[model samples]
Target: MEYEAATRHFAALGHPGRLSVVRLLLRHAPRGVRPTEIAGTLGMKSNTLSHHLAELEGAGLIGSAREGRSLFYTVRLPELAALIAYLGQDCGRGRPDLMPTHPTEIDMDRPFNVLFICSGNSARSIFAEAILRSLGGTRFRAFSAGTRPNSVLNPFAIEVLERNGLDTSGLRSKHVAEFEGPEAPRMDFVFTVCDQAASDECAPWPGQPLTAHWGMPDPAKAEGTDAEKGLAFAKAFGELHRRISAFTQLPFDQLERLALQQHLDRLGEA
Candidate 1:
């Protein structure tokens, strides 16, 4: 197994703001930035940015060294290299032309493609897909669609995603039928996060991707005042965050099909 510290490092970098900070450091490699300067440049409050910086440092992406009374943060080249190597640890396999120098530890010769299915594909499923897309690395790709499609993406869904720093400009809603065609994209995993979509029997497909039910409650169905509705969205967001963390943490290579199935089945059980 690769270093656990390195995985935590990658997890810390998964956040959009943190990813931006890392990119900034990469652009200014060798030359370190001070905490105050970083906060000012990112337009983030000193306290908020400091918390994020500390997390990055804990993950070993950035190193802090004291310079007189000030602390300077510099990108750690070896750490960055390790992160890249970890993500690419399972690159090309069985093909001479596609051999990868930095293969990921997890099996990525076939990057797992996951599809999230739900009734409307407006709130819960869309949120799950976006969270995975934002959190999951190159080893996994995520898509979502509704069994009975909606004409538009839910406004609240877009709001929550954007608040979490995900770009919703490119997201769209579609019917599950789109994936049934012969030319549809290959799926390695299919998850129905709502009870309705999980029970529906549908057409067969290639790979016969493993199926699981997450039973995430529908935020859109929440009724009452604006505050109550917002609470529903918050609840859904927290649930998705917890679930996505567990899903990406899976060691696909180490587990057999049955074990993997059991692991996925137990997700969100708590």
Candidate 2:
């Protein structure tokens, strides 16, 4: 992701104040600028400057290192250099034939991969994955697996999905181990539907994904007549669909990690 993603950098720099602040930081260079000094020089309120700094930091164009009790902010020159090299790589050292006449483009809609984990890949977690896929297919790739899968989806879960016009053709249960290795896709978010005690059963994934616990009563564990079990799956499906709908509306790229994590936690509670 060049420049914390070129689109993000451009977005963060689009504001006049942020642009000016970046230029100021650039002047300070390798030594860095203290937060107080930046606010004083820019004549910006501390809260306003903090907002700009968070945006810049999230875009990867800037970094901070602690100095005493204060944090010093500075441009990430190496990242900037890498972005320059990436843009120039296509120029073929001034080869007219290879160089693009127009500016480079970035696909800002790149999907963020999400994984849902549960004790059994049967009901709640599976429902979450399917709900997110159907609701946020434009911006998310959703997956689900269990610590110890039973090798079959709960028949009721499939029925609920199909009833809502969601595909269920290849919705077989899988072990979480399948996605723990190097070959697995890099996940941006990991939602654990199992409680804390049972969560330990699934091995930690390779990528340090942003994770949260969105536990719900496991619908598959309902011991009742067919109608009662169906009702349970339906409730889980409705709840997951509501959460996914709300999640997809978030300004995902604009949010810093901590803010994004907080939103995810709150979404589960709602």
Candidate 3:
């Protein structure tokens, strides 16, 4: 199957809240569930739950219908089947012994490593690193770097992130050189988050990591009053959170190498 649709499906399932929502709905399939019931059971805010529901519907993972003034949602079994099949279609193509027959065979303990790069690691790249760690720390170890490293991280970025419940402790602006050698942690994925870095000369990462461009404005350079600048930081943080949240939900063990790379590239698109 084409990878774009699978990316959307994976992105939809990435959020912890949405993943829970889908599983709960799956248990009550056919009969379906109302928003109130879902929110009550999950102990989630109504508005927040609504947003998750919308995402699930958008990805074709769930469906909704109006039942006399109340809305009900159910799993889209066919679409779910399609996603599973796509992930396994190329599995063990020439190596039968390597195929995963059970979920336990998936090597999740070998956490994936990721690196985010930009001209200055004070804003977009730093935010991407933090958000991914916060959301997917169990499966990923994320790092950020700058070609032109700053003496310290952008204070405004830290302030805004802390206000939104993220810990800003120990995060510092780092030079890309720190991760360049054979002894350094090899990255499984590398993302360039600014136009300057995407086009500028840079040292190659050691592993030939899957790469993508997710260019965003340098919120650290936002020209405005503090409040306005904070708004810019928040906006950039939100976008990174969404993308990283989606990234963590992919079925890594199930997908073929080429298929997984396609999804990663599609996810970089705004």
TM-score of each: 0.59, 0.58, 0.59
lDDT for 254 (candidate 2):
80
Show where candidate 1 strays beyond 4 Å: 1-107
lDDT of 2 by residue, 1-270 (tens): 444476677788789989877877654444466788788767899999999999999888899999788888988877766555555663246466554342132124678889988878888778888888878867889999887745578899999999999977667788888788888897778887755213244455555566766767788888789999999899989988888788889887687676776688788667
| Candidate 2, pairs of clashing residues | none
lDDT of 2 at 103: 19
Per-residue lDDT of model 3, residues 1-270, tens digit only: 468998999999999999988877754443457888788777899999999999999889999998799888978977987777776665335354544342233344688899999888888888988898799866899899987855468888888788879878778899888888778898888888875566455666665676777777788778879999899999999988888888899998898666776687677664
lDDT of 1 by residue, 73-142 (tens): 8788777776665555643223544433322233458778899888888888888888888888787888
The lDDT leader among the candidates is 3
> Which ten residues in a row are the worst by lDDT in model 1?
98-107
Give the C-alpha miss distance for residue 119 in model 3, angstroms.
Answer: 0.8
What do the candidate models score in CA lDDT, each in turn? Answer: 0.76, 0.75, 0.79
Query: Could you tell me the lDDT of residue 181 within candidate 2?
Result: 84
Alpha-carbon shift of residue 76 in model 2 (angstroms): 33
Residue pairs with backbone atoms closer than 3 Å in model 1 (clashes): 88-102, 88-103, 88-104, 89-103, 89-104, 90-103, 90-104
Scored by lDDT, model 1 comes in at 0.76
